[model samples]
Target chain A: ELKVEQNPLFLSMQEGKNYTIYCNYSTTSDRLYWYRQDPGKSLESLFVLLSNGAVKQEGRLMASLDTKARLSTLHITAAVHDLSATYFCAVSPALYSGGGADGLTFGKGTHLIIQP
Target chain B: DAGVTQSPTHLIKTRGQQVTLRCSPISGHKSVSWYQQVLGQGPQFIFQYYEKEERGRGNFPDRFSARQFPNYSSELNVNALLLGDSALYLCAAGRPQETQYFGPGTRLLVL
Candidate 1:
């Protein structure tokens, strides 16, 4: 079974703190994606990692992918109260053929609560 | 450009009834996919349609079906819905099928 696991299912941090959320997957895949979900809101795309050692950042969040190890990380720098939300990591196969969907398999998600 | 859009932001249905949810993909997008998201969980792929043809399906049962129109819009139909069917139905669109852009989901509450 293809599975994605995220560390620290719950994270509580103070403003200006830095932390990293880890995502480990079973099996090999070429693509990984991260998303954020606010209360009652749809998923907001965060990062798309395409290759090993791929790194992307936006705002206070940064993400990295290590395909060799089947791991990905989402690092939050200088956290703020408004940055609190649940984050998820999804993985998909490298290619899709007819009836073979590279549909993203997602992690259970990590809830981050920031304290002011 | 407007992102993907879904109708009936919320719905309430009785058990054993049927429900259909609609979605319009982003302009110029050719692929539409559907997902079921239970509370506190990630969205699970349900179906994928490209060019008005079914491309992929998930582990869901036959009671769930979907189709894409020529215009790239799609509909997800659930028959004989059960109480466990209550979930947030999400629609996403993409050029091919790998990287998807999701729309605000429709929340379904089964009574």
Candidate 2:
């Protein structure tokens, strides 16, 4: 089974500060994804890292993947109050010749609070 | 496009009652997936359907089942539900090897 672990489950930071959330998986995967969930809302896709050393950035958030280490990271720069939400990292297992399942295994998520 | 859409934004049911949830995929999206998210936990995959066929299932019991229609819409049915089955049910749409966009989700409360 593939297990995903994320650090700093609860984060509190001041506006304009920077922080990084880490996600580590137990096995190899074909791709990594980051998602954001606001209170009482469904998840919103953030980034999809497809290869080792893959990096993507949107606004003040940036995500990177390291396949060899089975690790991925979501970094936040100049945090704002609007960024206060839960973030999740998910992984998709490699596919087989006959076409395997494409379900995603997700981490527990990091709850971030940016104090103004 | 309109991302993904789910019907019955919220539902209240008693134990042993059955419930059915609906989903409509995004325009041009061929795949639909279902997930369950409990309070304070990550979402768990339930099923995946492509081309109106069941492609994969998660570790959920037989009580949970789903099917897709020709128009890429889907329905998730739960039989003999328990209090523990109460959770937010989410639907996603996408293609294989691509990112899945999720719907707002249906909040099901089993009393």
Top TM-score prediction, candidate number? 2
- What stretches of model 2 exceed 4 Å from their correct place? A97-99
TM-scores, each model vs. reference: 0.96, 0.98
Candidates in order have lDDT scores of: 0.90, 0.94
Best prediction by DockQ: 2
Error of 2 at A70 (Å): 0.5
Residue B78 displacement (Å), model 2: 0.2
Please give, for residues A1-116, the per-residue lDDT of candidate 2 as tens digits. Answer: 88999998999999999999999999878789999999999999999999999999999999999999998999999999999999999988777533366788889999999999
Indicate the residue-level lDDT of A64 in model 1.
99
Please state the error at residue A88 of candidate 2 in Å: 0.4
What does DockQ come to for candidate 2?
Answer: 0.85
Cα lDDT of model 1 by residue, B45-92, tens digit: 889888898888888999999999989999999999899999999998
Residues B1-111, candidate 2, lDDT per residue (tens digit)? 677999999999999999999999998999999999999999999999999889888889999999999899999999999999999999989988899999999999999
DockQ for all candidate structures vs. native: 0.64, 0.85
Q: Evaluate residue A4 in candidate 1 and report its C-alpha lDDT on the 0 to 100 scale.
A: 92
Instruction: Give the poorly placed runs of model 1, Cα more than 4 Å off.
Output: A96-100
